[model samples]
Target: MKKSITALGLMSGTSLDGIDLALCSFNNKKSGWSFRIEASETVPYSAEWKRKLREAENSSARDILLLHNEYARYTGEVINRFLNGKTKPGLIASHGHTIFHQPQKHFTFQLGNGTFIAAETGIKTIADFRNMDVALGGQGAPLVPIGDRLLFSKYDYCLNLGGFSNISYEEDGQRIAFDVDPANIVLNYLAQQVGKEYDRDSLIAQSGKVDDTLLKELNDLPFYNEKPPKSLGKEWLDSELVPMLKKSSLPLPDQMRTLYEHIAIQIGEVIHNSGTMLVTGGGAHNPLLMERITACSKAEVIIPENKIIDFKEALIFAFLGVLANQRQINCLAAVTGASRDNTGGTIHLS
Candidate 1:
């Protein structure tokens, strides 16, 4: 295995906030793995791109294919601009925008074709990191746990507050992780109702009152009751959660407040009585949500610096690429319920 590797990781999360690009270097030693984010930036999606991605799932096959390649080219262009005058990374690992993720149906698709990425950027690229696990009868979701276990072992629990919130930690002798609940995705949608991109610092939610009735309904969601090795997707949100929120007839602020409470409660139930939980991702910026989480859970919540909170997922995806390049396991059966531990990326040479 190489002693050190520098890679650029690109991540477009479910929240549609932007494409996060992080230039990172990883060093492996007998003791453990360590990493540094050399440079990072998030290029926000334009209105047109956002609309296309939001509706890609419902588009025709040909249209979806076209958008897939177009998105890859766009990603490549973004990388070119991001890399100008900077140290060029040896590889590009992209967690492509997910168009559909239904592992139970035996398929998952992430846009941004690796071939196009490599051709455009003229660098080795890795993409499509989830389908193999799904093909192996696994959820093919929550692929971040291996990174959490190896790179963030100091924390008793590593919780990411992304488009959706997922928690990873060691339990017994194995790593345990699963999607906790919807976080920024729902919050952003509610904020849009009020002509805001997102509830800044969760101010909207902080001012509103939580509706107990709505809170109870959200708490009783079947996904919350499902066992670990399970995951959630936008499809589940649309079919299960969206309708429930739509029927509430509550003010948007109240809905956001209740949703925040619901998220806190679900997370508290999972990490209850734990020691320390490292929280990152965009949701960590929402002070009100953090307060609610601290109020409901026993664990001490630690939010790292802004760069980490914003770019941790991109950093982990880059680590996943490094592991794949070394033929090391990046997806764990204990976390994703695959038949066995596996390396899960398709390498596209430049």
Candidate 2:
């Protein structure tokens, strides 16, 4: 195994917030795995690019294929700009923009072609981190648990509040993880309805009151009752969740407030009566959401420094690249319900 590795991780989440780039270094020592975020930034997507990506899911096959390469080239260009006068990484691992994720159908797709990224960046690249797991009957999600187990063992639970809220933790000597519920995806959509990008500090939600009827309806959704090894995607949100919210006919602020309560309840159920829970991701910055989660779960929630809150997922993706490069187990079968633990990611050598 390599003693040390520096890699750049790129992540484009479902919220269409931006592309997160984390340049991280990993060191393998006798104690365990240690890491440092040498540099990190989130390059927000332009209106045109956001529209293209948002509409890509419904586009014709030819158009989707074209956008895939176009997005990859664009990503490479962004990396080039980000790395200007910075340390050039040994590897680049991209989670890509998730366009279609349907593990139940035994397939998933993330845009941004690895070959194009490698070609444009002139560096070893790793992408397509989920297809193999889906092929093995896995959800192809919550991929950061392995990092939680190895790199963040000190925390009892690691909850990431990105486009969606997912939790990872050790249980019975195995890493268990799954999507909890919607987060920024739903919130951002509602915010956009009012000409805002997102509910800053969850102010919109805090200003409104939770409708018990809506909250109850959301809480009773069958997805929440499902067991672990399950996941969610844009399709599910569009088909199941979005319609429900629309049918309620409540005011937008009430919808946002009720949704926050619903999310807190679902997460509370998962981490009920637990130890310390480390919260990260963009949602961690939302004071109201954090307060609701704290009130519901009764778990001591610890929000780390700003860097970790915003870039932990990207940092872990870089770690995933390091493990994949070494042919070590990066995706856990226990967490993803794959046929077996496997090294996930396709290497595109430059």
Candidate number achieving the greatest lDDT relative to the actual structure: 2
Residue pairs in collision within model 2: none
Error of model 1, residue 23, in angstroms: 0.6
Cα lDDT tens digits for candidate 1, 13-92:
99999999999999988889999999999999999999999999999999999999999999999999999999989899
Model 1: ten consecutive residues of lowest lDDT: 1-10
Which residue ranges in model 2 land beyond 4 Å of their true spot? 1-3
C-alpha lDDT score of every prediction, in listed order: 0.92, 0.93
Give candidate 2's error at residue 200 in angstroms.
0.9
What's the TM-score of every candidate structure?
Answer: 0.98, 0.98
Q: What is residue 17's positional error in candidate 1, in angstroms?
A: 0.6
